[model samples]
Target chain A: MLTKRIIPCLDIKDGRTVKGTNFVSLKDAGDPVELARLYSEQGADELVFLDITATHDRRKTFAELVEKIAREISIPFTVGGGISTVEDVQVLLKAGADKVSVNTAAVKEPELIRTLAEKFGSQCIVLAIDANLVNSEWKVFTTGGRHATDINLFDWAKQGEALGAGEILFTAMTRDGTKDGFDLEANKRLSESLRIPIIASGGAGNMNHFTEVFQQANVDAALAASVFHYGAIGIQELKKELQRQKINVRI
Target chain B: MSNRKINIAIIDYGAGNVKSVQFALERIGFSGVLTDDITTIEQADKVIFPGVGEARSAMQALKDKGLDTEIPNLKQDVLGICLGMQLMCDYSEEGGTEGMGIFPGKAKKFPVPLKIPHVGWNQISKLKTELFQQVNEASFGYFVHSFYVPLSEWTVAQTDYSFPFSAALAKDNFYGCQFHPEKSSLVGEQILRNFLAL
Candidate 1:
């Protein structure tokens, strides 16, 4: 009877929140800590802060930001982007992050997932996969979805769960920023395929999209950026809409 | 010690988020110490068993330090969180392992169509003890696990998935929550406060 979570993802760059279309044309959103507080007040079940430039900068200010945000919000928060090593995971957790996500690093070094799971526990390690439809198959992409990996999305998700990843955050590159709806077929496939919780990210236009994802895909949570960032759908109103649709959600 | 000062000992067996758990306790105006030392753990007014790892390995770690035997003997009120709660049972399907036997039950995976790891917050109904005192019947608690304790005489609360599962259990000095009270919001904090008051 666990309630389906409504999560707001904040993409961070240079210590500020930003949103972009199709993972490009980034524009400043606001201060991460302030946005986090706002989301928490809006009844967001969890918050995902991804350092979009963590790999490029070769430095991690996300840890300090995580510390600041955790101090302000009581809800669970996950930090991702540019997390490659056990030390990186430790630094974030030590800075008060509830979970640390690894994407590009995990794709390159799969054993790093097992190592982090061992060191920080599975619940603390989240494996993020950016997937896109390539030649009628969901293919994994890396380096901020710029490079396409030959690995199949389903295969990678199973491997991630086997490696003790606590959860799988899957983003469909094709559906991302389109706002038409979630990649229902992809999410459904992954949700049915993986043993762990699957969080559907990328495309979320309105509350109906959330309902569609939760009801049809059976994803544990629905994550969106623009819809939540631009005040298109408030978390409370969205939860009400989901509740109206008979979806179990926290009021 | 004054009634205002509640000394809480968070058992450290090289598993779980001890810092976050400690932070939550301190946030609720309680003094908590994260320790593996037998003396300090035994001396605390209350003890919290927080764990997040494989059952067999964590049990082996506990047995290595002889804490496996010392834990069940403590007279103070004890609370087990997540894997710690699973370990308090008779056995676990995880690693085909035996548990601490504090509760007479076995932990197993939820049947298919209900998912394996019952992750996310779920509402708790059928409340039966002071541990849930003043908490709403529909109050939600954060959970992240694949296995759960079946209904038993020790069960104090129940939640439904593919079937009704034990959300909370209480027997004598031992209390177990499949959910993470530390990660849960106000209701979780109140549950901790109730435990501290006990």
Candidate 2:
């Protein structure tokens, strides 16, 4: 059986790990490499490093950080934030990052997805959609959920899959940082509509929240930042609990 | 463990990321030389052929470097990962491409009702061969692929998603893993170490 994954997201800024509340107001997590090693040792299924403050000047530094993390950690990890061009992805993968996620650039130039999938295979391309529920509709957002687009969340995800995105990481901006729970209705719909794996992000508060996302939404994976970063939920304990609850988690 | 100064070569034909494989080796205290040179690959004590892009392009890259013929002739322990494993087979349904015919099997697209590019952690059980030594049955290995080689005589281990497929294949001196042992955490690290020990 393919087990549901629990991912701890590390928001990178200036080569250090930080997390933001709803994409604003950052909190210091720790050193990227040390935090990554600890998470992998603690049984995190995978790790994600998002260069939240990605800029042209910081690209080399971010790639260096990625290289450092990859050199030390054995688990698979994805790097993202401001990834627009093929060269950007090439540099990161060459630095030993297993996969690279694309969010803002993908929405602007949808062909970027096809190009990346053709160049590096779909397995290395992750389409991350940061969306907000507005007027009872999930509208896609870019620039770390600051800007909105007219595209519907489900439709864009389907198109992304067709364009050769291996996985979809959907983050509900409205529910993020609230610790309410995953947006089950949106996640379930996306999973049902697409053949690619869906990663439910945001609104993860406790162990039961993960259980709800996997059990009710049936997503392939769940990703959170503060919950795992602040020691609110231990990965091993959560996996054990999910296993006890009849959810097939990697334990 | 064998105290051998193993010379490892990672065949790089520009198909995809070979750095991860090199990093995985580094984590286990070994360094793999990245080369597309026929002589370098032929001379290594252990060889790793890794690919991540389309099968047709990967095959073309192998042929361009004249590795299509040399890889099958190597007598040392050779391991293929992902698309490299598919290229070791007789044929691939992807892009209607033919393979190197080193292993007797065909890479076929996964059946309907199952997602393409079956990504994330899955168990590899019914283990066989030294490549899986000290690795527990049903141990999870990270996977990300749309095509799979069905059960065959060369199958050393199996994984189930849509159905039981070849998770690892071994025949003579050649070994292949559909899962990315380089990215599969400790279980995958153990598998790599086993191959190195061989």
Using DockQ as the measure, the top candidate is 2
Least well predicted 10-residue stretch by lDDT in candidate 2 chain A: A20-29
Per-residue lDDT of candidate 1, residues A140-194 (tens digit):
9999999999999999999999998989999999989999999999999999888
Pairs of residues clashing in candidate 1: none
lDDT of 1 at A129: 97
TM-score: model 2 vs. ground truth: 0.97
On lDDT, the leading prediction is 2
Q: What fraction of native interface contacts is shared by candidate 2?
A: 0.79
lDDT of each: 0.85, 0.91
Q: Across residues B1-198, which tens digit of lDDT does each residue of candidate 1 receive?
A: 147576789998877456667777767777688899999999999999988777888999899988999989999999998889999999999888899999999999777766656778788989988899899997888887878899998999888876788989998999999988887878888899888888
Relative to the unseen true structure, what is the C-alpha lDDT of residue A78 in candidate 2, on a scale of 0 to 100?
A: 94
**Candidate 2, backbone clash total:** 0
Q: Proportion of native contacts found in each model? A: 0.42, 0.79
